[model samples]
Target: MLRRNVRLRREYLYRKSLEGKERLLYEKKRKIRQALEEGKPIPTELRNEEKALRSEIDLEDDQTAVPKSSIDDEYANASERDPKILLSTSRNPSSRLTQFVKELKFVFPNAQRINRGGQVISEIVEACRSHEFTDIVMVHEHRGEPDGLIVCHLPFGPTAYFGLHNVVTRHDIKDKKAVGTMSEAYPHLILHNFSTKLGERTSNILKYLFPVPKPDSKRIITFANQSDYISFRHHVYEKPGGPKSIELKEVGPRFELRLYQIKLGTLDQTEVQNEWVIRPYMNTTKKQKILGA
Candidate 1:
């Protein structure tokens, strides 16, 4: 099993490294095809390769016309299988953090929470990987308040680290009447204002955490991006009269997530390159948005 895993990882990395060349070739083919269709001379730079590109284009069909990115491989089979998530907290977590983790367990449909105990991150990651867990979510707290969240995708990862803020768990909600009952059904997702490339990448990381919801599922989970802070909300709706008379209820445990970094490797890998990271002190406009336009 170990040998097979290593070989597979090597193959995956090689394929990813070739994506740039594949994209370039795809552009060349596109340019030649466009010039031919418009009855114009081929672009000067592409003229020498026109014959080869044209022949390749002739052999291509609808599916081969577009190039696929390496990013797509990360969650290629995500839709085919229900996401199995492992939720845990930092070692010797506080009572408040424990309760927050419990609330999170119910938030994700197939998630299972385990006591962190004295286990290290590497051990936890290996155990989850062996168990075929799709993703791992670890929450950290500072002075009994949940302040950090790490989401690591298994087998291969693009782990995302977020700083938690304004966390309001279900137990903390004093107004009992306003809180909606937690539903175990898979919730439909609403991702709003994720317009930029980084925004879309971040959106994909969060979106695959939940399995595909049934069309009629009343539970709704939303991740809305504004000024780079992602606001997470949970809710359930009811149509007492009809579709026109729909009523919405807010579920507790809402929070804001500010992404700090995204690593191309899993949580346990210390030497991996960072896919993206926030550098707040760098020279830039104060109003610049990283997650949206």
Candidate 2:
């Protein structure tokens, strides 16, 4: 009876040890597969263990760890979140493509770089619509590298000249009506990059292309009403010797036009005067309101 008891205990211990070993092997396999699919280097010990396991276990049965399936899942999730950039290898399919993709991933951590089909442009358009990206930045290299183009064939419209940088310009209700058509909004000037000199030239170009509105008395009144009040002294002298030399004559309640100075496109002298006449109207209104009979 003593011998039989010892034998049963030993068998039970042996079975428990085997079960523990199988559990360890399964865990190691899972970790190694995860690292591989993520393009991470596996550790030496783990790699060796994986090799041995491959010889013993049928890899075909481990369909849960397929790299392609993992990539597809990642892409689907990324597409649902942000703009998707599909990199086309057709333009230049080289090993460098991998590094380029990695660089793009680094720049836009949320973006995914997928191998594109022949319909790359359409894919880009769809991505823009789904993701609602304001603008597209494309890296172009004529030396057989991939070039990202504005997908929808939509024009980039006129850029505002800020003297130091080109900014996007928007059309107002009046401006849109004056334009009369979408074709008129197409970019008349192309700037390769943002530069100070380019901005000056762009300003000049915009001024040349668009008709500048002349500012009148009504415009001045409207402009003044929208701005902070500023009082400036003006001489109301009749002539050189017509009346006693007027000194410190108050003439205006001009708006602080300097504060509201806009640099887009160009402005004429009349516009500038209209922009500055707020203070005079303000002064007159104050005089009437306070010193009325």
Candidate 3:
């Protein structure tokens, strides 16, 4: 039954890929057909382009078409699926994922470090079922620092990959009071002075982290910003003015996190098909190394 489910998912991915390719071809053909009806000269290059796209799609289909035997073998070869993860960096020496994973274990003891080697996304995500991993933190390499972060939750997820800089942990924080709050209080997310595109990516991350509660639930989620830094303060407060809302006097766990990294965007695909944002895209503004670096 597990194998059947995995097979279905792979089929869905292939169909989605094909759809993207088909949409591009359809747009091109529609433009060409419109030109013909209007008696405009269609460029020969476009004709060549259409042919090339068709050929490419056909080639991709042939190359990626999964066999039933391979599907079974994938599950069979899966080493182990457990919430205890095998964290490691890509083979790049500059990668900090290995180091990050080391530090992370203290905070999230569920993770286990594996030697850095060649591991792709398909195997990791697939292993989620076969190996039973609850999460995968894949950090990709960049020139100065390993800035790409791919956080995949299993058996399914809000799998997010994004570029971040100035990443640090609680140990790095001098003010222990910085650890904010995680109470019965609905989470409030804020984004400060993020560029338009970056803001969208951060917003997506916030949504994933603090999804909306059920309609009837009174879980409070707030969004308030203070210039450059995001502040999340959770407390139940009452409105004597109109409604009968009151503040929850009983406080909860405090969680204060400091993230200096400017969110670039969703970590995009790199040479490693499963790895995201190993290479940055152009046009968007990028951060320079911090003053000390």
Models, CA RMSD each: 2.0, 30.7, 11.7
**Poorest lDDT segment (10 consecutive residues) of candidate 2:** 217-226
Q: Could you tell which candidate, 2 or 3, scores higher by lDDT? A: 3
Backbone clashes in model 1, listed as residue pairs: none
lDDT of each: 0.89, 0.32, 0.44
lDDT of 2: 0.32
lDDT per residue as tens, model 1, 92-144: 99989999999999999899999988899888888888789999999999999
How well is each residue in 203-239 modelled by candidate 3, as lDDT tens digits?
A: 4444343333344433343423323233333333345
Instruction: Show where candidate 2 strays beyond 4 Å.
Output: 1-92, 135-293
Q: Pick the winner on lDDT between candidates 1 and 2.
A: 1
Predicted model with the maximum lDDT: 1
lDDT of 3: 0.44
Ranking by lDDT: 1, 3, 2
**Predicted candidate 2: what Cα RMSD to the true structure?**
30.7
All candidates in order of TM-score, best leading: 1, 3, 2
Error of 1 at 35 (Å): 3.0
Off-target runs (Cα >4 Å) in candidate 3 are: 29-150, 153-158, 161-202, 209-211, 214-235, 240-293
Residues 190-260 of candidate 2: C-alpha lDDT, one tens digit per residue: 22222333233322322232222233211111111111221111112123454465332212211121111
